[model samples]
Target: MASVSMKDVALAAGVSQPAVSYAYNRPSKLSQAQREHILEVAASLGYPGPNVLGRSLRSGKIGAIGLMMMDKLSLAFADPCTIALLRGISEVGELENVALTLFPLNNNRLVGRSPAANHGSLALRGLVDGLIISTLPDDHPAVLAVVKQNIPFVVIDSPLVDDSFFVGIDDRGAARTQMQHLLDLGHRKIGVIIDRLNPDGYRGPIDPQRFKSASERIVRERLTGYVEAASAAGLAFEDLSIIEAGGLDSTSGQAAAFTLLTSNDVTAVVACSDVMAIACMKTAHALNRNVPQTLSVIGFDDIPEAVQLGLTTIGQPMVEKGVYAARMLTEQLNAPAGTRLEPEQKIFATKLIVRTSTLKI
Candidate 1:
């Protein structure tokens, strides 16, 4: 059967096509009763409203934004921090009547395609009015590619590129504060568990050379913070035990925790994330080590689970980070043509939430 068009709806409703268009697009142009009558008539004629493709072509906008992340789609949803951030973005998108398109840059389904190769293609071909890039590494191929495209974008964290709005906390300072808490508690022996230095899928102790080659900016800064805090306490950097979890999930974190706790005679552990810290706590339990009495653990990103688990952590405004990034991008996209928005860096504060996981000895 032939599809019903606005003209057909207008003819059946005894109204002009432009009047039908106003009923859908500019409802204020028609009275409530008139608009309702037109809609009812159109509905009876099986008209499903406007052609989104045609409207997009006419307005140069698809009424959508892209949310680019470094992890696969499944991992992104599983992550508590990412979920909270998404909630904030969704709130804004709801108010603006915009749609969200997720681009998982690390999705393996691309069939033998390298991240750079896929990112290059995606940057050139992806269709969205603007982008919200979260936690991609500095010098990532996608970052440069997106910048080159002259697309309006907001960066959540990492790679503070030129002409891009940025939103994040002081990672190094937050990490330092986290470590300082342990140090102030007089814990000399410390073990550090990190998600990964890079995306190489290597799970083991991180050496100085490997640490230097870290591609992820946030991870590198957090490690630096731990090192700085230890150094300030007159501890040697070489003596600090650093283990890479190789992944952000619980399994990798548990494996890294087991390795660190079993090999090192550490009195405390500092994890790069709450996930890792919770893993450390579990490992400590399995090893018959009591938290704060025999072992102390500190974590970053005070996720919801952290409270229930009593994990001491650095609390960042996760949802606020998302809300700020989305708002900034939307503002730029909604601006008048040729209006230049000065890209601003929004750095939120971090707090130390000392829970039952740490003890001074």
Candidate 2:
């Protein structure tokens, strides 16, 4: 049997070869109706469209985007916040018929090579048209490699770089607002549980310098916001009890909550994420402490579980951030050469979602 070609599909559809190519490679170049007709005709003729690999080589454009996260791919799928953001990105990618690939950092099992190193090499080699980086680490090797390659990309939930696009919330302000809710509830002694402060993943008692040099911008900024809010309420920064969770999971949350609950000074706990807040609530239950009545708890991200648990939280537009980030990458890819693809840094507002977890003393 003979294989189908662009010309065959074009002739069958009564369109030019370029029109057929535009239907698959650059749908934006043709009118919606025309593109739909070309696609339908090509499909009817059993033409699976152009070979992505061959088309990419010919046109210098790949219909795919990469999303790089600091954590493992499994964890990314498990986290509600990450999942929401991914769903948003997926929606945009679906519209453009673009594949969104997950790139993990530090694949420890791949001999001596790191996943970050591998992903960086691929980015530099132009494996994907663009990238959406969701990690908070500023100096990540993967991030630096992408920047060095001069690929169009966007950073989500992280600090804005002059050369890259960013879509995120004001972490410090969001943290401050959430923490203030606890303070307003007459919770003078509040404890905080956070993920690691540095790339080294040190557990427990992060020093001032380590905090200052935190690779995760969100963590540093949120910590600063919490400190500022606590200070305004007459609480000294040093006086705020802090617990470093090894990771952003319920197990770590439980451990941090146990430590904080055992302390005599902490009457409230502010978890950096909803997962941790839920764990804290579980810990409170284990300790026979009534939430709000004994220990008020607040969280960030306002994941669905937070509302179910009646935990007060700071709600940021996670899905919207992902959508905007994906859209920015798409625009960069479609833009003309020498066109400044630098999208203005977009900061979504965060609102305080009050619930039953907090109450005035």
TM-score (all chains, Cα) for each model: 0.81, 0.80
- Taking the tens digit of each residue's C-alpha lDDT, what string does model 2 give over 1-361? 8877778887998987766756754566789999999988888888876553444445777767788776677988888988998988877733356677777665543112433554436555666877888865766666666676677788997645666688888889989998988887778888888876765756665556667777778888889998899988888877788877878778888988888788646788888888988899999999999998988888899888887889888998889888888767665664434556335577899999999988788
Per-model lDDT: 0.83, 0.77
lDDT of 2: 0.77
Those runs of model 2 whose alpha carbons end farther than 4 Å from true positions after fitting are 1-58, 93-96, 108-120
Clash tally for model 2: 1
lDDT of 1 by residue, 5-80 (tens): 7778888989876677667644666899999999999989888876434444456777677888887789778999
Report model 2's TM-score to 2 decimal places: 0.80
* Candidate achieving the largest lDDT: 1
Q: Write down the TM-score for model 1.
A: 0.81
- Candidate 1 residues lying further than 4 Å off, grouped into runs, are 1-58, 93-96, 108-120
Reference-based lDDT, residue 328, model 1: 76
Candidate 2 — worst ten consecutive residues by lDDT sum?
106-115
